[model samples]
Target: MPLITIIGAGPGLGLEIARAFGQKGFDVALVARDQSKLDALAQTLAGEGIHAQGFTADVSVPATITNALQSIRETLGPIDVLEFSPADRTLESVDALKVTMENLQPQIDFYLGGAVTAVGAVLPDMIESNTGTILVTTGGGSLAPTPARGNINIAAAGLRNWTLNLNSALADTGVYVALVAITALIGGGRPDAEPAVIAKEYVKLHAERRDAELHYVAYDR
Candidate 1:
């Protein structure tokens, strides 16, 4: 079975994504900071008959992410699909006017730096094998700046830009790269914005391997 590594795996979209891929015969390796939570997620997937294992890692710390990916590779085979979507719950967003290097740096480290580290760890093997899929998740703020999440938007935008560029660079390498920018509150009453609904897009992206990005906009504004 193919293996998919979901960084920042949690109870929401992460779990749904795992289920979607698992339904399609992909074994899952969930990476997150909380071991207990990860274990719970793994158990849940197991109950669903999806072979899954959890690896703990804090995306803010590049070393931890690297170590977790190495462990995942050792436990499950090489990653066929890499989905990065870490939620940083510790940092508080500042307004655009209040943004500073101190405030913005952490977002940079979490969003952009983490992605670089994770991709670097697996890209070599994917390139050698000539088959892989990379799916990155960000918020709508990354595409259109909002005053509330200034630092996050900046960092996410950087990640989005890099992902698109990487897609272009790997055009003929058999490694597909795509980004999913969610523009609504997931599971926030809208049927279209539910986690399960959104997750189907990930599976579609991997299967089709055509689009560079998908903007899952389920909001009015």
Candidate 2:
């Protein structure tokens, strides 16, 4: 069975994607900094008969993520798909705009550096096998500039461009890279932006293996 590693697995889109991929017959490796949460999620997936394991790692640390991925490979198998998601949004409000540069750096590191580390951990194996998938979850802020979410926008924009370039370079190698840009709130703030609905787009990205980017936006206005 193929393996999918989800970095920053949580209660929202992360869990949704895990379940979505799990339904498609993919063994899952959930990576996050919290072991207890991971255990709970793993248990939940287990109840559904999905083979899932959790690995704890702070995405800001490359060594931790690399070691975790290595452990996952040893226990489950080589990762066929890697899902990159941010653990939290650092600059969440425009009113709280007095944040210093130091605080902002971690957000960039989490989004841009974290993806680089995770991909680097698995890309070599994917290259050797000449087949794999990389899916990045980004926000519409990356597409359109937003002063309120500057941190996320900057980091996500970097990741978005990086994924596109990586896709171009890996096109002939059979390693597909794609980005899912969420244009609205994920959990039904908008009619079409439901988590379940977004999860399908991820499944389609893996199955179709054609598109390099998907914009998931929902509005009821």
Candidate 3:
């Protein structure tokens, strides 16, 4: 079975995504900061007859992420699909005038730096094998930035552009890269943002090898 490594795996959307691919017979490598949470998630998947293992790592730390990927490769074989989700999602409105480097740096490191580390680790193998898929979960703020959340928007935008550029560089190499731009409040108890519903879109993205982007809205326009 193919392995799917989900970085920043946690509750809600992450778990749902795990279940979605796991049910499809994909061995899952769940990476998160909390060992207990990862173990619990793995046990739950095991109960459902889905193969899953947990690896603890801090996404912002490149060495930690690299180590986790190495351990995962030794345990679960090479990863076929990589799903990256930023662990820090706290949104604080910052004044455009007051936005200092200190305020913006955290988000940049968490989103952009973390993505570079995670993707770089597995990309070599994918390139050598000539097959792989990278799916990043980004917020709509990245596509349509607002001054109200300038820090997050700026960082997210950088990550989105990075993914697009990576995809361009890897074009025609049998590796597919895509983004799921979520415009809705995920796991906010709304129908459209439902974890299971949103997860299906991810599965579809992987199976169909669709375009480079998907805008997932939480409510009807």
Candidate 4:
């Protein structure tokens, strides 16, 4: 059976992806900071008699992620799909943006450390197994450079490009690196943007798993 690990299990995207895979008979492992949330989700899936397990971890911490993935492998076998759902803010809005060199540095550091560490911990396993997927949820932060929000953008773009480069280098090795980015409000398209419709599109992007460095899932206006 194929095993999948979702690192950032949001109620919508995270849960939806898990549900999709579960429906397809994949042994899904839900990973997040909140054990209760994963528990509730696992319970719901169990009601459907889906084989699911909830694992908790702070993906930002390499050790936590390393141990967590090891446990999942032990229980469900090697991970076939590694999904990074960002327990922290994948999207940083302008309203909450505080432009400070000191404050922003930490955020940048976190993103870089988080991405590299998470990928590092799992890449080896994927290579050894000879076939696996690492899916990172990139957000609008990767679109462009920002004055206040540039830090996250910088980090995401760095991860995306670095990942693509790695993928190119490893093409003969049989491992794939991909990014799923949410460009607009995931729910709806303005007053006209229906949340359900937008979500479907977002889901499609992940399902497609395009080789593009970053896939911007946006609603048509």
Q: What's the TM-score of every candidate structure?
A: 0.98, 0.93, 0.95, 0.83
Report the C-alpha displacement of residue 135, candidate 2, in angstroms: 0.3
lDDT of each: 0.94, 0.86, 0.89, 0.70
The model with the greater TM-score, 1 or 2, is 1
Count of backbone collisions in candidate 2: 0
Candidate 2 structure quality by residue, lDDT tens digits, 1-221: 98899998987888889999999999999999999999999999999999999999988788999999999999998999999986564444332265466656777788898899999989998999999999998888778777777656777789899999999999999899999888877785765777777888999999999998988778886
Tens-digit lDDT string for candidate 1 (1-221): 99999999999999999999999999999999899999999999999999999999988889999999999998998999999999887886899999999999999988999999999899989989999999999999989868899889999999999999999999999999999999988988888889999999999999999999998899543
Better TM-score candidate (2, 3): 3
lDDT of 4 by residue, 1-221 (tens): 88778887767667777777776677889888888988998887788877788888886567887888888988888898887757366545332255456555555556657777777888898898787777777766665554555656666677677767776877777777766665666655453233344334434544665564555556565
Model 3 whole-model lDDT (C-alpha atoms): 0.89
Q: Tell me, by TM-score, which candidate is best.
A: 1
| Candidate 3, 146-205: lDDT as tens digits | 677777778889998988888888888989999888988777878888888999999999
Q: Which runs of model 1 end up more than 4 angstroms from their true locations?
A: none
Segments in model 3 whose C-alpha atoms lie over 4 Å from true places? 89-95
lDDT winner:
1
